[model samples]
Target: MPLPSIDWTAQQKAARQRSIAGGGKPGLTRMEQLAGKSGREVLEGMMSGELPYPPMNETMNMWLLGVDIGRAIFQGIPLPQHYNPLGTVHGGWFATLLDSALGCAVQSTLPAGRSYTTAELHVNIVRPASHRTGPLRAIGTVIHGGRQLATAEARVEDEKGQLYAHATATCFVFDVPMA
Candidate 1:
């Protein structure tokens, strides 16, 4: 198998451009502002593109599609780009999607200045996925949220609702100082 072609010049330029652009919503500088809004509001901003979607979403071809207080849903397609050496969608891609959903589900429950990071993640792949799986959805819901920690669960499934993978995550909650 040959390595994918690369245009280092173009790739470098694109990387530079992305950095200067600031990955999230423009002109929103205060992390406290996020803590001030309900989880729904923040998720809404991401979905509406009022907030710039994370660059990773573009790289993975996945994006936040829906959210509520303690739940989030993401959609993606399994493309050749995600293929593993075995020619199936890599387990890491499934884990990434589930992690995003799980983390965001906890994020949706946070207050403006508050944030959480994945302290631990556990994923179980029940069925292999590939480009042939068509489009898929990852749905996450918060199982518990406390002052210092949050736990969420998520599952990845095809359009017809066949389960491919599922996961749970623990996040360490913290407050960021406002400037």
Candidate 2:
């Protein structure tokens, strides 16, 4: 069955407005400012504009929406630039969205002075997406957070809750180096 129509332009506009209201802009937080802040706190800072959002988000047409203790939510707008030669959204786009959500989900669980990097990632694309797919959301939740490793899973769905892709990631957790 066809998914219900969505006013994606309005949705994107609303999201951008919220980001702007919160002080969000594409940039990176300085390590000095990040020192002693927990992962969740850092994410909160980015959301509220106390810290700069990642520049990659602008390039990919995606941004973080929210974060919790061990979960992260992100939204993306697929455009022609993201399409593969086959005339649909490229799998790399799906993987990038999922990776961001999954990595942030794991990061959300880390304590101050700790960080993580994805050691392995597995993505499963269940449905094809295109520019017409509208705004899709990726919700990521931590499966496990340990001293040395963390695992997370994420799913990408449209506004109507139709799944397009799902992914899992294992991240290597380590202490952040102080300079």
Candidate 3:
């Protein structure tokens, strides 16, 4: 049987709260600050269609579901240790964010019952993000969706909108059996 699902937002929130409560050191981590933002929740809600998207004139910090390239966006926060010794955001962070955004971009295209898994991923880390770079945004989209594979492209930008990384992922779809 399929296992019980974990609520992503709730789980992340509780974990952060616990870490803060434990308190070996003080101050909210960068990821924590970004994840706790109301804009972040808005993005999640928009993806689930719980919230209606804004007008074209509306400028939102959060990612909106099914947005065109102009306004499309998705954000992610990694653990405190997600950075390199130089205190720069690691490539792995970009990998995960690109994976999620690319997969979710495909997910937005899927019909009910049919899901997808990443078949292959390729990323190029052009630069790195310092603490000053703040959180990160991985914007992704389906370049092409074929019968067997869906192609996606993603760009990872720091808070300043600097292009830190870019990637392409191919997702294989699971074609559900018809009743």
RMSD of each: 9.4, 3.9, 13.6
What would the TM-scores of all predictions be?
Answer: 0.80, 0.90, 0.58
lDDT of 3 by residue, 1-179 (tens): 11124443343344334433544122222332223224334334344434443231122122322334212345555544667777776777678767767877776666544557899999998986654555566778789877688899989875456888899898898765544
- Per-residue lDDT, model 2, residue 62, is 89
Q: Which structure among the candidates has the greatest lDDT?
A: 2
For each candidate in the order shown, give its overall lDDT on alpha carbons. Answer: 0.76, 0.87, 0.57
For each of the candidates, give the backbone clash count: 6, 0, 0
Q: Mind giving the per-residue lDDT tens digits that candidate 2 earns over 8-31?
A: 556556656676787777877789
Error of 3 at 159 (Å): 4.4
Which residues of candidate 1, in runs, are more than 4 Å off? 1-35
Strongest candidate by TM-score: 2
Model 2 / residue 10 / CA error / Å: 4.4
Q: C-alpha displacement of 153 in model 3, angstroms?
A: 0.3
